[model samples]
Target: MPAYFQGLAIGLAYVAPIGMQNLFVINTALTQPRRRALLTALIVIFFDITLALFCFFGIGTVVERFALLQLLLLLCGGLIVTRIGVGLIQEEPTLDQSVEVDLPLKDVAMKACVVTWFNPQAILDGTFIFGGFRAGGVAAGESLQLILGSSSASFLWFFGITLVISLFRAHIGTKLLKAINTVCGAVLIYYGMGLFLDGVGRVQQMLSSLF
Candidate 1:
């Protein structure tokens, strides 16, 4: 029981920050229909939970042990994230409520996956945090309970935010939405550039070591 609560708290702390996942969800809620927004939230939750599981189970160790893997992830994730940001910046927000601007379900899922799985920061952070907990004398049953609690947090936070945004979307003007998108897009591009630079530095170090 204590473990479960601990996991719940950690999970909220892990996810409550303004990041790619939250930005994507918020944008969907603002632009898409209520059903589509909720579905996007669900897709994000699925990816988040699976990512948590992967980190808790030992993927973190694998990433740590393999410099090549880390380099590839950084480079690929940066490119993809940067492209997504460019798209958001270019997108023109509409005031028309009658027009369906909803993306296809597959597109939603793909974006969710990229924002969750391709995020090296999220992966590395989750790996350290959850992996640390797993290494810290937790019993198997307790670990399971902890994971369940974390999953619950993802469910609660995404759905709650989506519903709230959907309700207030009427009050949100197109200008405000466009501003939000621009800001979020800039942030993402900055983050992506950092990742790409880090990847480049890693490559340089590897080459130096071999020489």
Candidate 2:
């Protein structure tokens, strides 16, 4: 339950979610070279941690208060994710499993940083939501160790995700990769639907609660 661990727990909840980063990471692992994938993952985690720290400190409050902001994000995110899933379903991986392409390291790193950091929800999730919870623990004068416990859990998950992706990349066959994509697509669709429903429920709940 050290402070480091506490920071890490905050890290996990943010990363473990199925989002654009996960899709990119998985796709890189399945398609690109190992080094490329690793670098991509590192960029992603670094961005997440930095954002998380920012949120926990203070920058996230603005987001937390903007009630309609999150709803708008969820709807847009759902659409984008669904769009990607549909694209995956339409294209078969094996048709172009050519191993000749290489991910431009500099570009990929820059792009990953931009995409991951620019994501509003990523900030909201890490720095605002999770960060607020951590701050409350700190404010309550909860044991630093206990407070850190959550963060450590999150850090471990980040490492675990990276390791798992790398390890699995070695053995993933073309067909298996396709299967994985299919499953991932389904997951994206489910998440999209869930988000849409949650948004609708919130509106309904707000209206009823108003009455």
Candidate 3:
């Protein structure tokens, strides 16, 4: 396969998992107006590409070297995501056909930014996946192609997620929407806890080395 195609494949595989970003985008699409939701996806896509470029271009290795930085990132990200998850769980979207909630556009955009940029798994994906490709002896010309391919994957995935949600909106009533929010919240909490634990593990390792 061509380098570009290879990169595309790698990108798709990495983004396929249902993580914080995916859940947020899906939730946004379901809850918000179409234009705002689409804009939210676009913001996430922009960050996704930016991170990929940062990692593939060699900053990822530098990040990996700093165990302290990694620990900080994990802890911060865990706390933030966990808080979000808790909020979601606590504030179950009202299923009443009579009541509707409209989240502010800025709020949605801010959340999208936090979920993408502050997500440790997302950073890891960029570092490990894209960075791995870079280390695999890709030529300079092919490097650009790879970056483009990976970016395209983000574009496709975000839009595709919203599209799927939009398709089933009418079929999925308030009850089903509540169920989806609950599920997303649970998954995020689980994911965030894992990140926190990982950070703790790293701390233990650091102390062990120091002693």
Candidate 4:
């Protein structure tokens, strides 16, 4: 019970952060139709569980142990996220009150996977946050409980956000959509730049320690 509650709280705390993933989900919900957005949310949930499971099972330790790999992930992820952010700024959502533009199912799935899996922060969350909790053993069957609690948090948050956006979508005009794009883009770019800088700093620190 304690393990389950602990996992739930930690999971919520991680998802609550205004990071690239949350913003992407919200933006998708606002711009895309309910069906497509729901699909995207499911995909996001899948990746979240996959990552958490990987970390909880101890595979994430292998990846996180190498500082060089972490640095590389940060660099690559940062560049991709920043590029995406810039592109989002230029692309307008072609949605109106009566009309809904639904992205192809495959396209939505691919985007959801990329945005959820490739972010460096997401990697850190799995490796550091979930991995740390996983190290603290739960009761025999409690491991499953913890995983359920964490998975539930992901499902609830994504679906909840999607539902809210879907309900209010008609009231949300195009201008507001554009504004969301702009803000989300800027925030993603900032996160990317920060990731890049953090990688550079980590490398520098490693070098200094060696010298």
Candidate 5:
């Protein structure tokens, strides 16, 4: 397979999992108007692509070299992710028949930024995955193609999911929406706690090395 196609497959696999970015986009689609959901997806796509580039270039190497940076990211990202999950769990779901209050573009953008940039797991995973690809003996043109293909995957997946959810919005009742929120929130909290624990473990290892 061409490098572009190879990257496309990897990208799809990477983002297919139920992560913060997907949850945010899914919730937006379930609650907000189609236009707003689509816009949110675009904002998320921008962040995702930039993040992928960062990881592919050298951020992973930088983070790995700095234990302090890694610790800080894990703790901070855990707190932020857990907080977002709590917010989702506490949110009252509005029925599809009711008037939907749309979040401002700025708010949507901020949320997208948080889910993508503040997510430590995504960062580490992308960093290692993309970084490995970079470490491979691929030509410069192939590298560019890989990046483009990965970015295109983000665009397609987010937009595609948003449209699908929007089309089925009418059938999703308030209860179902609430359930979705609760489930997504719980999963996030679990993931966040795992990150925090990982940070704690890292701290212990660092301290042991010091002694």
Candidate 6:
């Protein structure tokens, strides 16, 4: 496939992994109106793109290497991820609430950015997926191009979803919102467990090899 098409395929594959951050952004947009929700989505995109650049560079090496580092990250990060997933699953969606209390774009953006930056899967995707692709024979520009392409898919899905929600905001009640959260959270919990188990297995292997 051509580089552009390759980028598209890779991008879609890259963004397909579901997570809390995406769920929150989608939920926010659907619950809130244009300014606040779009700000949230844009914040997510900004963090994702910035992290992609960071991982593309040599910065991720420190984390990618060393079994101990992986363990550290998994133990701390995985727990956090699992917690967020559980939180989402437990949340009672309040879809009936009026879309009031306008949040400033800057503040909303900053919070969304922080939330996106801290999301462990964001790191994994940026570091593992994007980083791996770039490390391959692909040109640097092309690698970034691929990442941007992938990011676009995320942007499109998120914004597209928000657009639909905004259009039908009146109809989607708490039950539907709760169902969405439950599904997203269940998926996230599965991913978090996988991360935890993978790290545990690596540690076990490292120990076995020591003897």
Instruction: Please list the C-alpha lDDT of all candidates, in the order they appear.
Output: 0.90, 0.64, 0.82, 0.82, 0.90, 0.70
Instruction: Output the lDDT of residue 101, model 1.
Output: 73
The regions of model 4 sitting more than 4 angstroms off are: 97-100, 205-211
Tens digits of lDDT, candidate 6, 84-127 = 67987897766555538477777777656645665666776667
Q: What's the residue-level lDDT of 49 in candidate 1?
A: 98
lDDT of candidate model 5 versus the reference = 0.90
Candidate 3 residue spans exceeding 4 A from truth: 94-105
Off by over 4 Å in 6: 1-5, 97-115, 140-144, 200-211
lDDT minimum window of 10 residues, candidate 4 = 94-103
**Clashes per prediction?**
0, 14, 0, 0, 0, 0
Predicted structure with the largest TM-score when compared to the true one? 5
Clashing pairs in 4: none
Root-mean-square deviation of candidate 3: 2.1
- Deviation of model 3 at 148, angstroms: 1.2
lDDT by residue for model 2 (1-211), tens? 5555654555566667777677767776667655666767777666665665567667767666786877776666556656666776665764244565566778887656644665545655666666667567664455455335544554465556666876767666778878878888887677666766776777788799999
Model 1 regions more than 4 Å off: none
lDDT of 1 at 172: 86
Candidate 3 residue lDDT tens string, 70-121: 8998999998889889887776553343434466767866787788789888
Give the per-residue lDDT digits (tens) of candidate 5, residues 123-154: 99898889887887679789888988898899
lDDT value for candidate 6?
0.70
Answer with 1 or 2, whichever has the higher TM-score: 1
